[model samples]
Target: MHPESEDDSLQRHRLHPSSLLFSFLGQAKQFFLPFLLLFFAAGDSWELWFALLIIPVLVFDTYRFLTMRYRFAPAELIVTGGVLTKNERHVPYARIQNIDLKQGPIQRLLEVAEVRIETASGAEPEAIFKVLSLSAVQRMRGRVFAERGEARPEDADEASAGRTEPAPRPELINSLGPKDLILLGLNPGRGMGVVAVLWGLAWQMGLFDGALNFESILKFFTGSEEGSVLGYSALALGFLVSLFLLSITWHFLRLFDYRLELRGDDFLSQGGLFTRHSTTIPRQRIQLISISESPLQRWMQRVSVKVETAGGTGQPAESRHWFAPLIHRHELQGILTTIDPHLQIEQASWQSLAPGYRYRMHKLSVIIALGIAAICQLIFWPWGWLSLIGLLPLFAWATQVESKYIAYARTGYGILFRNGAFWRQMSLTMNEKVQVVSQHQSPFDRGHRMASLRVDTAGAGQSGHKINVPYLPTARADELQADLVAAAGRGEFSW
Candidate 1:
């Protein structure tokens, strides 16, 4: 037989030697706090015991590095490793949904990356090659796509020859400029979440111990015991300004130079300021698409697009599920059509909820308002009663306005559901992607002869969006569920 070529040799090789360093760092990062605690608990001569403890860790790492091996077959990837208990896994290329790569400063310098291969079977990645050479990663990507018959021209070269030419520019589907990123920051204003994290960290570090308190902050904002409204108003304004500034900064750092591209059968998103990040979503694997607009986003005539597939949930920022982080409102249909020609949201005939839906909402709102007002009165007395008056009228007006916009539609290919008052979200699920069709009625719904319909697909819960239509006439809900079930049955589900 002829000598095995370099590419063939790579097919059965172990991970690069750098894997040992990364594996050790990963272990240290995970157990640093625990080990530190133990170090202190062990007293002054803790160094000896600490060093002894680490010997076992070093031995385990060495054993793991020596034993672990992977092979690329024509149809599947075979990974085998473990010392005490040998383990092997065969991951078929067709079942793979995502192959995400991460490169921090050091990894980039070393021309290596941490690769996570995901499939629809579970929440976590199916295979994680902690560290691999850049060339190896390229070959892996090429082989995966090639085996699935979705490989681009360059993918074939990288897979077979372990070399690639300069890539042709991909089709730009959508991109976020500075203005769009700013708007995204303003609308989502996600930076407020950082305040809690910072506060926790500060508390843990003893920075807040006897240094700051809620009472002091209240006094600073309100001034004298009388609690001046102007002072509190100023404090509120300052707080909001801080949140907005933080949000803008956070967005810039995480999503700087964001762009979404369509190359062959894949959707690629790339962004980040310090460490570049990218995510790839295969076109055919998309199970659900959602368009959402917050009150601020709507006012600005902007919306965000997100998609879900069978794989990946609670992923890191680099592997997020956003299809288009932000896009102009008018571009919604155009973008949808570009993603898939079959999507026609504007053409679908929408149907509002059943009659008395508003009445039901108003009744529930009154009960909630009364309960809140009673609890407040017990705590704050006179002024608390005023809340009920305000809440009742507010709820009445909200229910009236929101009931008009809450609706669902049976599109030719899938189901579309839209709801929300201040923050509206519309979601579409193709019939072929639907995994389950469910109908239910609560006591209140039964009283009004109403029911709810929910269509679930893979990654449904992970998307933070669902096709659940409420307050439909029981008959309509039943009819919709049956129709959806029939349609789903007709089309074979793809990953």
Candidate 2:
């Protein structure tokens, strides 16, 4: 009668029938571009070969669908399958980190979703269910969380029985409509990436085979001896405008109808235009939160917020959670409160970098600018010396403005850091979540009696932001490091 006893006695269940279709489609996507290339470039003679390739893929998918079997157990999920080797995996509920769900347009139409089971072990999901009935996924989710003590027994019972019970009312934290998405798209990032992708795609399609010419491009920029600089300037401006528009469209489409909600101890987000994604993160799993603003966003008085959680290191940038893609500056505090009460950065007593940091920043910028100017002079002699006219002032403003904003602080619940001038970012890592605290000193730092402090938490990718506070007085850095190490020792890391 109990859900536990029922699960313990249950037999292994096969994947939903639609899984065969979904698996076949997944394989088809991988070959679609190749098939197109064969048809367009290699001609109809290769059609038979392409069909032959599909035959093996179809057979593989069919065999996998038929062989795969999964079932719920008292304390773990057991998955078994394989052709000859006959592999089996038992994943304990306590070790499960994330249970993510995805549904494409077709899957949504068929009332099925793809499920990814993640753990703290690696970047890839521990297990993936290609296509499962929505009801089955709900049941699995409830069971998993229930075993972890995060869900009620009655909820698990209801889910296991496949009842159409009313869903819980989750409080809406933020919702991004078309206007908000447009605002997010207007942010000054992702343009170069979009341009690069489009250029690559065009190259693959051979759109530039005969139309592009390096010499012609040089001539266009150089123009006649009395070249039309105005004409080339307009052309460059048009290209940049096109790139910006493309970036906007990419962001808009990728995050269409985005919504964030709070359901008890979990933060849930669902978005995407073509393929909807639903991510559930337990509040305790969150490691760090970052709020960032670019020059354009600063002018608009807006900011973007994101969260880093434990596990899944090396995942793509899009896989990271966006707490608020774009929100007004005034709304940040309220959102932070909903995320956690201890993230009150505005109220924290912020500490400025070492007194010599400004001098250090200026010295570094001067060295870089002088190096650039020297290289320019080597190439353009007379005109290159004139580079200091532009470089000096630009570097001066950058160093001075950046030194003014770079700071670190200790919050009631975490350590907070603020850095950058052009693309400013503020990061907060909770004291309890801190895993490692380190201090480093270089020859340059020693010359100025300065050092850098770094705090590492779980799931922090090398490419992503973490709590690294540079340009601190050696004594100050030592003091902060000691405090953080003690705090980390006082609390236990859940993951």
Residue-pair clashes per prediction, in order, are 0, 0
Among residues 3 or more apart in sequence or in different chains, the pairs in candidate 2 whose N, CA or C atoms overlap within 3 Å are none
**Model 2, 282: alpha-carbon shift in Å?**
1.7
Best by lDDT: 2
Give the winner by TM-score. Answer: 2
List model 1 lDDT by residue over 274-350, tens digit each. Answer: 66566768888888888888889989888899887667654533233778888888899988887789999889999
Question: What is the TM-score of each predicted model, taking all chains together?
Answer: 0.87, 0.88
lDDT of 2: 0.80
Off by over 4 Å in 1: 1-10, 38-43, 46-48, 149-158, 165-169, 189-211, 214-227, 313-320
Tell me the spans in candidate 2 whose CA falls farther than 4 Å from its real position.
1-11, 32-53, 164-167, 190-227, 314-319, 374-382
Instruction: Give model 2 RMSD, 1 decimal.
Output: 4.3
- TM-score of structure candidate 1: 0.87
Supply the TM-score for candidate 2.
Answer: 0.88
